[model samples]
Target: MTQLETAMAILMKTFDTYAAADGNKGSLSKGEAKTMLEKELPGLLKAAKNQAEVDKLLGGLDFNGDSEVDFSEFVVLVAALTCACHGRCKK
Candidate 1:
Protein backbone atom coordinates (compact mmCIF):
# COMPACT_ATOMS: atom_id res chain seq x y z
CA MET A 1 0.00 0.00 0.00
CA THR A 2 0.98 3.59 -0.51
CA GLN A 3 1.89 5.75 2.48
CA LEU A 4 -1.49 7.45 2.51
CA GLU A 5 -3.26 4.14 2.21
CA THR A 6 -1.30 2.76 5.13
CA ALA A 7 -2.08 5.83 7.18
CA MET A 8 -5.77 5.48 6.44
CA ALA A 9 -5.74 1.85 7.41
CA ILE A 10 -3.97 2.68 10.64
CA LEU A 11 -6.51 5.31 11.43
CA MET A 12 -9.36 2.86 10.93
CA LYS A 13 -7.64 0.26 13.00
CA THR A 14 -6.89 2.67 15.79
CA PHE A 15 -10.46 3.87 15.95
CA ASP A 16 -11.83 0.34 15.87
CA THR A 17 -9.47 -0.76 18.60
CA TYR A 18 -10.62 1.97 20.93
CA ALA A 19 -14.26 2.03 19.94
CA ALA A 20 -14.61 -1.67 20.60
CA ALA A 21 -13.40 -1.35 24.17
CA ASP A 22 -16.83 -1.10 25.70
CA GLY A 23 -19.07 -3.46 23.71
CA ASN A 24 -19.54 -0.83 21.03
CA LYS A 25 -17.85 -1.96 17.87
CA GLY A 26 -18.84 1.07 15.85
CA SER A 27 -18.52 4.14 18.09
CA LEU A 28 -16.65 5.51 21.07
CA SER A 29 -18.32 6.20 24.35
CA LYS A 30 -17.10 9.19 26.34
CA GLY A 31 -14.77 7.09 28.46
CA GLU A 32 -13.41 5.33 25.40
CA ALA A 33 -12.79 8.62 23.68
CA LYS A 34 -10.99 10.01 26.69
CA THR A 35 -8.85 6.91 27.00
CA MET A 36 -8.04 7.01 23.31
CA LEU A 37 -6.95 10.62 23.57
CA GLU A 38 -5.00 10.09 26.76
CA LYS A 39 -3.20 7.08 25.35
CA GLU A 40 -2.91 7.73 21.60
CA LEU A 41 -2.77 11.51 21.59
CA PRO A 42 -1.07 12.38 24.82
CA GLY A 43 0.82 15.22 23.20
CA LEU A 44 -2.42 16.88 22.17
CA LEU A 45 -3.83 16.48 25.65
CA LYS A 46 -0.68 17.87 27.22
CA ALA A 47 -0.75 20.86 24.89
CA ALA A 48 -4.22 21.82 26.08
CA LYS A 49 -4.02 24.84 28.38
CA ASN A 50 -6.35 23.22 30.89
CA GLN A 51 -8.65 20.29 31.53
CA ALA A 52 -11.61 22.38 30.39
CA GLU A 53 -9.94 22.94 27.06
CA VAL A 54 -9.51 19.21 26.66
CA ASP A 55 -13.12 18.70 27.62
CA LYS A 56 -14.16 21.31 25.13
CA LEU A 57 -12.12 19.68 22.40
CA LEU A 58 -13.76 16.34 23.08
CA GLY A 59 -17.19 17.90 23.26
CA GLY A 60 -16.67 19.59 19.94
CA LEU A 61 -15.76 16.32 18.27
CA ASP A 62 -19.27 15.08 18.76
CA PHE A 63 -20.60 17.16 15.91
CA ASN A 64 -23.94 15.35 15.72
CA GLY A 65 -24.61 15.72 19.44
CA ASP A 66 -24.95 11.93 19.70
CA SER A 67 -22.71 11.74 22.77
CA GLU A 68 -20.59 9.17 20.94
CA VAL A 69 -17.93 9.60 18.32
CA ASP A 70 -18.27 7.46 15.23
CA PHE A 71 -15.63 6.91 12.55
CA SER A 72 -16.31 10.11 10.66
CA GLU A 73 -16.11 12.25 13.75
CA PHE A 74 -12.90 10.52 14.78
CA VAL A 75 -11.43 11.23 11.37
CA VAL A 76 -12.22 14.90 11.74
CA LEU A 77 -10.31 14.99 15.01
CA VAL A 78 -7.29 13.32 13.40
CA ALA A 79 -7.43 15.50 10.32
CA ALA A 80 -7.64 18.66 12.38
CA LEU A 81 -4.70 17.64 14.50
CA THR A 82 -2.71 16.66 11.46
CA CYS A 83 -3.41 20.00 9.85
CA ALA A 84 -2.46 21.84 13.00
CA CYS A 85 0.84 19.95 13.26
CA HIS A 86 1.57 20.37 9.57
CA GLY A 87 1.29 24.12 9.92
CA ARG A 88 3.48 24.12 12.99
CA CYS A 89 6.12 22.06 11.24
CA LYS A 90 6.14 24.29 8.20
CA LYS A 91 6.89 27.35 10.32
Candidate 2:
Protein backbone atom coordinates (compact mmCIF):
# COMPACT_ATOMS: atom_id res chain seq x y z
CA MET A 1 0.00 0.00 0.00
CA THR A 2 1.00 3.59 -0.57
CA GLN A 3 1.70 5.99 2.28
CA LEU A 4 -1.82 7.41 2.30
CA GLU A 5 -3.31 3.93 2.17
CA THR A 6 -1.11 2.81 5.04
CA ALA A 7 -2.06 5.86 7.05
CA MET A 8 -5.75 5.20 6.46
CA ALA A 9 -5.38 1.59 7.42
CA ILE A 10 -3.65 2.65 10.59
CA LEU A 11 -6.47 5.00 11.40
CA MET A 12 -9.05 2.26 10.91
CA LYS A 13 -7.04 -0.12 13.04
CA THR A 14 -6.56 2.43 15.75
CA PHE A 15 -10.21 3.37 15.83
CA ASP A 16 -11.22 -0.27 15.87
CA THR A 17 -8.84 -1.07 18.65
CA TYR A 18 -10.32 1.67 20.78
CA ALA A 19 -13.95 1.16 19.81
CA ALA A 20 -13.81 -2.55 20.57
CA ALA A 21 -13.07 -1.83 24.19
CA ASP A 22 -16.65 -0.77 24.86
CA GLY A 23 -18.24 -3.70 22.93
CA ASN A 24 -19.90 -1.27 20.56
CA LYS A 25 -18.03 -2.01 17.35
CA GLY A 26 -19.74 0.79 15.47
CA SER A 27 -18.83 3.77 17.64
CA LEU A 28 -16.64 4.79 20.55
CA SER A 29 -18.10 5.53 23.94
CA LYS A 30 -16.82 8.63 25.71
CA GLY A 31 -14.36 6.61 27.78
CA GLU A 32 -13.18 4.79 24.68
CA ALA A 33 -12.70 8.10 22.92
CA LYS A 34 -10.74 9.51 25.84
CA THR A 35 -8.51 6.47 26.03
CA MET A 36 -7.93 6.59 22.28
CA LEU A 37 -6.89 10.21 22.47
CA GLU A 38 -4.65 9.73 25.48
CA LYS A 39 -2.93 6.76 23.90
CA GLU A 40 -2.90 7.67 20.23
CA LEU A 41 -2.71 11.44 20.24
CA PRO A 42 -0.83 12.50 23.31
CA GLY A 43 0.90 15.24 21.41
CA LEU A 44 -2.37 16.71 20.30
CA LEU A 45 -3.67 16.99 23.84
CA LYS A 46 -0.43 18.55 24.98
CA ALA A 47 -0.41 21.01 22.12
CA ALA A 48 -3.89 22.11 23.04
CA LYS A 49 -2.47 24.19 25.94
CA ASN A 50 -5.67 24.08 28.03
CA GLN A 51 -8.81 22.16 28.75
CA ALA A 52 -11.02 24.51 26.75
CA GLU A 53 -9.04 24.02 23.56
CA VAL A 54 -9.19 20.28 23.99
CA ASP A 55 -12.89 20.48 24.72
CA LYS A 56 -13.46 22.65 21.68
CA LEU A 57 -11.58 20.26 19.42
CA LEU A 58 -13.39 17.18 20.62
CA GLY A 59 -16.73 19.00 20.73
CA GLY A 60 -16.36 19.80 17.05
CA LEU A 61 -16.39 16.12 16.14
CA ASP A 62 -19.82 15.35 17.50
CA PHE A 63 -21.84 16.72 14.63
CA ASN A 64 -24.74 14.31 15.16
CA GLY A 65 -24.92 14.94 18.92
CA ASP A 66 -25.01 11.22 19.66
CA SER A 67 -22.19 11.53 22.23
CA GLU A 68 -20.41 8.63 20.63
CA VAL A 69 -17.87 9.01 17.84
CA ASP A 70 -18.25 6.87 14.76
CA PHE A 71 -15.57 6.12 12.19
CA SER A 72 -16.42 9.19 10.15
CA GLU A 73 -16.05 11.41 13.18
CA PHE A 74 -12.70 9.84 14.05
CA VAL A 75 -11.39 10.34 10.54
CA VAL A 76 -12.56 13.93 10.45
CA LEU A 77 -10.65 14.65 13.64
CA VAL A 78 -7.47 13.26 12.17
CA ALA A 79 -7.94 15.14 8.92
CA ALA A 80 -8.70 18.39 10.69
CA LEU A 81 -5.62 18.06 12.87
CA THR A 82 -3.48 17.22 9.88
CA CYS A 83 -4.75 20.24 8.01
CA ALA A 84 -4.18 22.44 11.03
CA CYS A 85 -0.62 21.19 11.41
CA HIS A 86 0.09 21.55 7.69
CA GLY A 87 -1.23 25.07 7.61
CA ARG A 88 0.92 26.02 10.57
CA CYS A 89 4.06 24.61 9.00
CA LYS A 90 3.38 26.44 5.77
CA LYS A 91 3.01 29.78 7.53
Which prediction has the highest lDDT against the true structure? 1
Candidate 1 lDDT by residue in tens digits, 2-59: 9999999999999999999999999999899999999999988888899999889889
Which 10 successive residues of model 1 have the least lDDT summed?
82-91
Instruction: Give the residue spans of candidate 1 off by over 4 A.
Output: 88-91
lDDT of 2: 0.85
* Model 2: residue 27 alpha-carbon error in angstroms: 0.6
- Which candidate should be chosen as best, given TM-score against the real structure? 1
Q: Candidate 2 has which clashing residue pairs, if any?
A: none
**Per-residue C-alpha lDDT of model 2 across residues 1-91, encoded as one tens digit per residue:** 9998999899999999999997899998877887888888899888878988867766677879998889999988888778887885342
Q: Lowest-scoring 10 consecutive residues by lDDT in candidate 2? A: 82-91
Give per-model TM-scores. 0.92, 0.86
